[model samples]
Target: MKNYFDFILPTPVLFGPGMAERLPTELRRRGLARALVVTDRGVREAGILNPLLAGLDAAGVTCCVWDGVVSNPDADSVREGIEVAKRNRPDALVAVGGGSTLDTAKAIAGCLAAGVAEVFALREVKDPRASLPVFCLPTTSGTGSEVSYWVVITDRRTHEKVSIGDPALSPTLAVVDPLLTLSLPPRLTLWTGLDALTHAVEAFLSTAASSLSDLLVKEAITLVVKSLSCAVDVGDNLEARGDMALASLLAGAAMQHVGLGLVHAMSHQVGGFYDVHHGLANAILLPHVLKFNAPECPDKMKTLDNLVEGEGFMEWLKRLYEKYALSGEKVEIKEEDIPTMAERARANVNAQTNPRKAEVQDIMELYRKSFKVVE
Candidate 1:
């Protein structure tokens, strides 16, 4: 059987070492004047914001800082961010942290442009236009928010995390400078890198997978396998950092077209409910999800074996998890919570795109295996 697919790569990606140095030029190229710098308090305090501010100042671009973004960026966070952006009326937005900060910036930009305080008003259900141009500078190698069209935001009222995706929200420029990732803590480096790996693996096995996406996923998986450990162990290794960054970009590009799977669907529920880091949740669930899906997609699992190299692909992943200290400690995966989390995962958008047709029971079983609640 012949497979046909459509590919879209709209965001202009600027990748390499020190690419962040070009931020001023990129903003000016977009004809942006006043800019709102969106990021979290952590990154702001890390002193990472200094160089970016210097670049903007050197470019003579008037800018204001909004450092209130929180992890798992909730509705109220977006609303407060929008209020700030509206007051400043910045001509552009510069996102300067990880996925949470970038997602918040994307939402704030869209809401400010639409003149709505409620981000839900601009949800996939609503017809919202693109807002001020957004330029993303990702400090983490996960989530791929810099290149992806999707943004996951939690609605505080319902405690449900819904994703908003529109081509209109894609960043005008993605500055992937490996240097910024060098200071990341080891645990964060491991989690985020694993998240990037999950993106590649899921996209490769997606029912929507195409030849073009497969090419990207193949290379991405290889790079992640080879470099993730080094990047995690030696946080300051620029070469490893560069490889992971490129791997993340390729994975992001692939997911943009092929879509994700049950792992993401299930992970979203955990993130919304627990306020856990998105990458860690994805990491802990990845092996179990792979084990669940492996029976259905043996060929894809074998393809992964080429990168990780073990008696079998799943064993290879298990070994990698052990090697990275990602899988040793036993966390509780309560059988009781399976039904509820499974229901949520089943309802996620990515669930429909999973290669295996997962019934509620199938999802619950997978969740039961994946969840490790400390008890």
Candidate 2:
């Protein structure tokens, strides 16, 4: 085991129907008092924080909320959050929202620990120094930022999404409470669920896949396959929501362990270029990239095909997009941008994990094929 592989799940998790209510107690256990809450507008406006805040109040924990986090958290957004962090001087951080909000909170915590003014500074370093304690409450079950050791922070100046991988970025504690996600509407439900599916599929296909990650990814995929449709179609169903939350967490851990593939690399470039939702771009790219990588990992693809009820893995991925109505959204991307995006994707370290080594022209072809394919 020593020479073969190393696996670590650094965060302690508290999972249940109302686990977010346990936050104040958990913070106190960590010897924390004043807290900075990093979140997005949806969590606040949807009234998801009322009960959690009431619990914090009852536990005598004070907080300052920074709810300006945007989708695809950029350097400017994180810097703004850090300013809030500096003001509050909170002893701990509570990240409450979806993937973007959770990532914002993690970067804010990392910036405070590293003594850095901008998240981009931390991005340039191989292993950032700051490792702040973070309590994560995932209102969306998609990105799995709650349990992962990596984050994608966009540089505002260039609009390029920089992927940062460091163990220091993992949350100190993760609270997966399905009740908090009851407020997640159907569109978000579809996007995030598909994102979780992509995470599982990518990790399972990664060349770095180990016996340990394979087990985790398989279970994660099973959960998504069984629960995503139920969770999307019936948002308030506690059982389905709980399964998806677990699936996202497991898929995240698996991805963090084995790394991802060309899908994330290609889609991230598009997301940065077109300002498309990360998951939406991933949903569009998953089947195409998988088809490209399938030849290199036919045995793994066959395993996945057997697990999922479909004609083939490719058909299964297509059905997932169609089933969730993910194909209808217009991409609005310029054809001229395809080559640049492909070059950027090839340069991205994420593309290295593809079972098949992706060529520059291969990615270009993929990007061109993806443009205006919806009908």
lDDT of 2: 0.83
**1-375 per-residue lDDT for model 1 (tens digits):** 016877778889989998899999888877887999998888988899899899899998998998999988888889998888878988999999999988888888777767778888776435566678889999999878899878889976665788999887888889999998999888898889888998998998888888899999889888887888899889999999998999889999999888899989988887776676788888888887887788888777777887675466577667777776665134445555566778888989887778788888988766666665443
Provide the clashing-pair count of each candidate structure: 3, 0
Q: Predicted candidate 1: what Cα RMSD to the true structure?
A: 1.9
RMSD for each model, in Å, please?
1.9, 2.3
User: How far off is residue 33 in model 1, in Å?
Assistant: 1.8
Which segments of model 2 are wrong by more than 4 Å?
1-3, 125-127, 373-375
- Candidate 2 per-residue lDDT, tens place, 303-337, comes to 99887874765676677676766562367567677
How big is the positional error of residue 147 in model 2, measured in Å on the Cα after superposition? 1.0
lDDT of each: 0.84, 0.83
